[model samples]
Target: MENRAVLAAVLMAALLILYQVFFIPATAPPPPARAPEGVSKPVPPQEKTAPPPPAVLPAAKVLPRLPERTVSVDTPLYHAIVGSEGGRLLGWTLHYRGEKVLAERGQMGLSGLILERSGVGGQPVEFSITGGPVVLDGKAGEGTLVMTGEDAYGVRVRETATFRADQYAVDLSVRLENGRRVRQTLTVALPWIAPVKPGTDGAQWPSELVWQVDGTVHREPFDKATVAEETPGDWAGLDSLYYLTALIPKRPPTSPGLSLAVGKVGEDRVEVGLRGAVTLAAGEVWEARAQLYAGPKEYRQLRAHGLEGAINFGGFPLPRKYGGLPMEWLGVPVLLVMNFFYRFIGNYGVAIILLTVVTKVLFYPLTVKSMTSMKKMQTIQPQANALRAKHKSDPQRAQRETLELYRREGVNPLGGCLPMVIQVPIFYALYIALSVSVELQNAGFICFGRAPGWFPFVGGTDLWICDLAAPDPLYVLPILMGVTMFVQQKMQPTMGDPNQAKMMLIMPFVFTFMFLKLPSGLVLYWTVSNALQILQQRLMNRKPARVAGRGAKDVARV
Candidate 1:
């Protein structure tokens, strides 16, 4: 945000949607927050700043061009091709996910380091490859690919990428030696540079620039206007919905720099990197090491590396510290439970079902108590209304009698709502866990096939529920979920306004349409939850309610 006023406005807007009584209102969904905060140079509202300019471009080189070579490093975890030109990562394919991370043609492919003078417009140091085609044997367990080069500035550069057979992470270390007689300070940037047009926006597979500073992580929209923090932090990188590529510093740099940014590198090109400077006296070598994580956002896997923050579990949209609600605390536990269930069940779809069942059971006592209180209130409402009518001439007495009736009936007005209130955090966390857990990707539950040309826009093969992470192609789970929710709502005792009851009934359809495109795993969870609620309500109705006779007895007295 440009200033406190803007920040406050954003916070208020976020609060309008978050923490609402009903997640999906009878009204339309609230609009989105304008943007997430970026920790970078704060600019004046009237003054516009370009994304930090690309690292300085070197002056036209009169020297001959050094040949660029691509070296292949095949590990058990990943197959990668590295370009020698700038030590850029050319191609990376995760063995487990079987997804090839695409890289734009011109920009550094996310593993290259660029050296420039200590500010914008600083001349970038160019490297000429003077090394071999890096070699590594995955069967040997571990190895390193070293690409050595030297810049025109009296500096020698060594970029070594360490690979292990069993890990998704690759550690990169850059060793720089000042070959000059005098001391020199140069800005160092490791960029995940890509070609993105200005004002580009997307959500299906969003790419955000993330960085941590002073122990807090901030994710910024890849705005056309660059956002880069000058103060260096633990790490910076770019990530998409299911995949992550982050740079975590193994240790703080010995030499500090003038600026650090996760921003743009050039026109039509974007970058997210930790920028710093190293001042080295002649003949002195400075080295910096960072761990690069490039893999699926498996909660347990990333957590093991302390990089689990890369997963975007939707949080409370807010003007709060760290820019939003930190749902990870609760969400992580839910995710862990779901994964644990997966280990036992071997199918993520069933795992999600088990998770939902466990959650319902865990909160069963709270749910029963809430329902009981609502039933009690429903039972006594008519008598309370009669008392109010009797004392209508004296409004104070009417309220007073209503309170006494409530007390005698042993009904706590807030009981029905308070337990639900206590459960809200867990509910929100479960939603987030279902949404962001990557294990559900392509994890199947069931599949139904359609004959060729059976319906318009319908294909031949079995598509329904084939991928739990994707929407149900036939809209089965969402409709079932909605139906279950409506039935559950209808079965519950309504104690308040009739119009509110009707609105509550209408919520099912609204959510049905909303869930049409949501991941099937989430829809499955909702459906199961609603079904459980319905079953509980039916069982409660079957057994004579403890307060069922109270209403009739009180009405007779009246």
Candidate 2:
């Protein structure tokens, strides 16, 4: 019996590993080869020994410098800033989450729309105010903000940003006019940036440069290569696990389309940007249009813009395969239900508990039958042992006779395992859901200060858990869960060799150690579940007559 349970667990683990290895696309490419430290490239030989009169430097490209002022725009969803210096998005804040989505704590606040001419030391095309501040009411469809300026090459650049009140998308239009009577090729870029702080909450989410090229999602980590693999589509930007700042073109760009650039900001953070370049002819006003979406990676919100692919649902988002046994099949439904529960309870901890209860209820009948079968096996153990000893010389005969005895008593050898085996998918699906759902970020179940006044040791202090998404700081939940699991295991009618029983006993501790670092929310779910099973088993044990068979059959020898 112990071997059967162990085999079931092993099979489930193998399937999950295979699914991840074979199905989940590689979001992070191989790290590029590193340059040898302390070994500089060999200097090329010069034709003449005399350093030819200081190699001429390329001409500096500049734009008219306007007095730096932050233009503030407020919407129901987010607050944004446009710097007059470069007409760049300086700051962006999501109101509900109180998180800054734009660049902070670094130079080069070229956070949104900026243009660069093709020359050495080329400055970004900074715009001057072409009109008064544009305002959009929440009831309105669109609010337009326009700024116009000229580059050092005398090329007129007009930038227009149409902000919407109902959604996170901003319609961006950039027009380059070659008013200088000379054609110019300028690199147009929509920069999306967030400071990288390794090994923090910020590091928990993957931050990478992602773009679609011919329908394939190509992602490059910010700390990876500097030069990007020039993807063709104008859809490119940076994203973290929970939020996405992307530039999606209304139409694909001409030749020399989407290119990526990665840079380091001081010693602490890295910057990633996607640039789209287009050539403008003399007396032409070439407009490059794209929609900028910078906000939380809510599935429904992003799905509306055909950017649903950005929401990594912790598994393949394709239609159900393996006859709907895929993790996504269960995970998505569980997540949606949990979200619905949160709407009423307003607490994720409560929602998770409700979900656990719902799962337990759904499997209640199967679990009861499994427990009854285990109890029957426990009752027949002595006779089974006697038969094993009597027929020790005939192994096949002993197995056949044992199966006959079990059938005569109406017992199922595999009954204890089959029910649990069926639940592996649902368990894993819930686990994955809890791991990656952004709604659980910073959600709290129990905090010391929030505890009741009479609660011992944990009341009026920060000693207990503060965030359900993080591990239990005091390790209390994991230890309790381990203890409950062990108790449940002990209460079960486990019929096995002594060594096997000892191994089964140790499984609880092994699981406890494995779950120590998992999110407290998940641990809480497991703990509650284990406690419920123990209670259910105890109740079932008191009703032994319910599963009792005829006395003669129950006493039959194998």
Candidate 3:
């Protein structure tokens, strides 16, 4: 029964395959068409469209240059004037520093520097700025003047001068905007143009260029404004001996191409800038911002702005490990003491005298030792002269013999000098401190008010000896200093060669000449020191001072 069912299933499968092959077609039959020839075809016309007109930028603008004008800036500390030309920092009258602006017009009364960019493609170098009559009115008011200018290519520049109330500093920023169609490389410069008087004029603040680069400070006279080569500096500006004008970068420039270029422009002008290729694409901005300090170099105030190094207390030659002659370190305390005394005495000049007295008193013992040693040398001078004559043909032998004679006579050749040598640093420090002390600016020991037109070196409203920071107009202090030095030299034992006495005499005249233009404060100190030494010499001569050896008693007191 199973074999029969399988046979029937096979037959049914065969029949199903036969039916499918017979009924269905392998491919679809062609459809019946109504029109199958070119007679029924139709062609459409072609059309070409032109592109939208190419974009054309407007020609670079040529704006009318406006007349330059001065904008007034008033703060608690100073009154400043900023000009529309290059947005230059024209001048500022210092109110707190107690100094009147005596400079003639266009003669950098103070800080005519820090704004100008390198121009290209016949672009005018100076920006024709247009802004406002800036008013920084009250004590707390942020005195800000933002002046803007643009060139023919639409390259705009902005200069901003901001003042903080009751401070001796002004914040300045220069920003460049590239509105050109092509990329632009901008070079910004802030230069000072002033007719600087040659040589040391005591009344004039000496002109110089100062810059800080790579943790080092550099200085150059006005004649040598720029460095030997371009360098990347943190700040650069022209500085007077006491007043400082700096353009300090607000931050380290990320671009390596930017460097500071400083150099004299023409015969009278010197300038500095954050100079380099500050490349800007079209519509991009490049900014060179800095803090401007235009005031007396007060230690504390300058330190506040990280400009204490600008004070320029003369550097002493020494290895890096041992700061040679701690001038600033010692000078600072010296200043502090002077100021401390000033607080009580209300007179810096009197404070200087007191400081001299204190120094003399402190070193009285050393002075006595020096005097006694000199006295001993004088007692043995005749024998020393005989020995020198005997050994005249042999110079080295003469020196040895002189030394042996000194040893036998209990005389120290360096004794008189060593004591004074020990005090040299103090004197030098005092000089440095006084030379740069702004507190002494317009400070007077004796005031005769304004001098007559006949006053030498200074005329017409010339303050006569009214400012200790300046040279004595009448030259009285210098002459007095010379006389005191002469008297002091005379009191010292004349034990050396006869030529030595002549040299000593010549020194007083030389010093007088040198001090003739030196600041009166330093001259006053030296004069007072000489006077004190002479007084000490007279007193010690009567006391029969002993030497440092066994026969000290036998050494006759001068």
Candidate 4:
């Protein structure tokens, strides 16, 4: 008996040590490296030298041929045609397909492609296209497409359809004839260029994407790989999560100039502006064409526009970070299905509820078997307790006898936990899906309040109670959840000491607090699931009781 007690103690100790060592805290893989801080131009590799300088076009050779028919030009920027069949442009070339800005220069500080300026009120002079004097069916029709700056701060150029057939491929161009010799410095802000590394002082990694001039190369620094706060304000509110600058080469003789600036307007938007400067002779025209992309991180649209690697779906902290990929992968299918269902249902909240129901139905068999096993064990608890009392001084013997009792009753001690273990991954997957799905970011639910903010709060207060996303501050949902769990436990046959029932009672509140901050969508699922489990248990309990004596001896075989 003494030897058996020692052996049991050693085995239990070993199991506990193994559990602590292997399962206590899960670790994730290392993340990718972040960009370095401060500006240091990247040196071209000796093996791959920079290409020879571009050929400059002279004024006479580059001038467009004038058409016989005269048309009135009324826009602030003069629109002119270059070739008989080429497109027309105001002072600049009309880049209908959009031109990538290699680099820009102006009265601003440049970091990569971000240009920063203070006190400048006028719009940054950039490229713009002149709408068509398009000819349709060989008949001249008049319509103007004007691309201009919203304010003195920036320019927005959009494609416009012209009725002129000859204008299909117009050669658009811009000419900047400045009166003063502007002292402008150019900076490259292309993603293809090496990223600005994070500073050693642990300053926030500059939240910007890199752009390339020569080729379609872009790189978005992974949020997990860097320590940077997503600046909040109008820009963030606008949901313009990421930004990039294009780098284009200079047109001619005047030095290629690039400018990038970063500025903040109070607590509103963090504006990033890029400008290209050309020093013009009194009558000389310094022209450059550039393309700008300003929108949400729509990966497909961005890639279609030849802007690759510019979409940054911010990654969360560590072990959680590793989970992003799997979560996104799972989300794709779930979102698709949910979207389809929502189209038919017209209610996101109802869709979620229906989705939960479908999931429960699919998992019902496993749950049913688990619950049935628990019931059987509950029925046999009296016998298990008798065995425990019989060998009170010898735990090993008691445990072995309990096992024998379980076997005779055809009960598996781990049966109930097995199904629960399987459900954990799915639950976590749902958690991740709800957190990052942009569709759900600002989605609304039934009166529970706006879906939830990035994090939960009560009426914008920090106090934990009003956080509906988290636990019910009133303890209503959690209390109900706990009650259901307690009933589930009661309905199940007991396997260990009756004292453990108190521990089971504590689990619902523990889980409730843990889930309070979670999205209401998740909470709804759990609440429904708990209710269903209770209903299922009640139904299961209604079945006739098993004849005990006949199965008692048979339990040892299992």
- Candidate 2 C-alpha error for residue 145, in Å: 2.7
lDDT of 2 by residue, 1-558 (tens): 999999999999999989977998834223234312111112245343454232222234554456766677778887777776556777666754445444432432346456665444345566665544555566666677787777666667788888888888888776766665444566766665554444443222336766665665555666663543344563665667767777776653333434555444455455555565555444555655667777776666776776655554444333233223346467678878898899999988989989999999999999998888888887776667767787899999888878877887678989889999888778878887787676766677776445555768656545566677788877999999999999998997765688989988999999999999999989998998998899899998898743356434644623
- Sort the candidates on TM-score, descending order: 1, 2, 3, 4
The predictions' CA RMSDs to the true structure, in order, are: 18.6, 20.0, 17.5, 24.4
Off by over 4 Å in 1: 1-63, 102-104, 117-140, 180-185, 197-206, 224-229, 252-259, 317-324, 448-457, 460-462, 494-496
lDDT of 4 by residue, 315-418 (tens): 33334335533344444455556666778986665666777777778788988888777777766776676777778999999999889777866789898789
lDDT winner between candidates 1 and 3: 1
TM-score winner between 1 and 4, please give it.
Answer: 1
Better of 2 and 4 by TM-score: 2
Highest lDDT: which candidate?
1
TM-score of each: 0.80, 0.73, 0.69, 0.48
Model 3: residue 45 alpha-carbon error in angstroms: 51
lDDT (Cα, tens digit) per residue for candidate 1, span 135-234: 4454557777776767766678887778877777888777887677555667677766655542233212335777777667777766543744466676
User: In model 4, what lDDT does residue 38 have?
Assistant: 19
Supply the global lDDT for candidate 4. Answer: 0.43
Cα TM-score of candidate 1: 0.80
Q: Positional deviation of 376 in candidate 2, in angstroms?
A: 3.9
lDDT of 2: 0.68
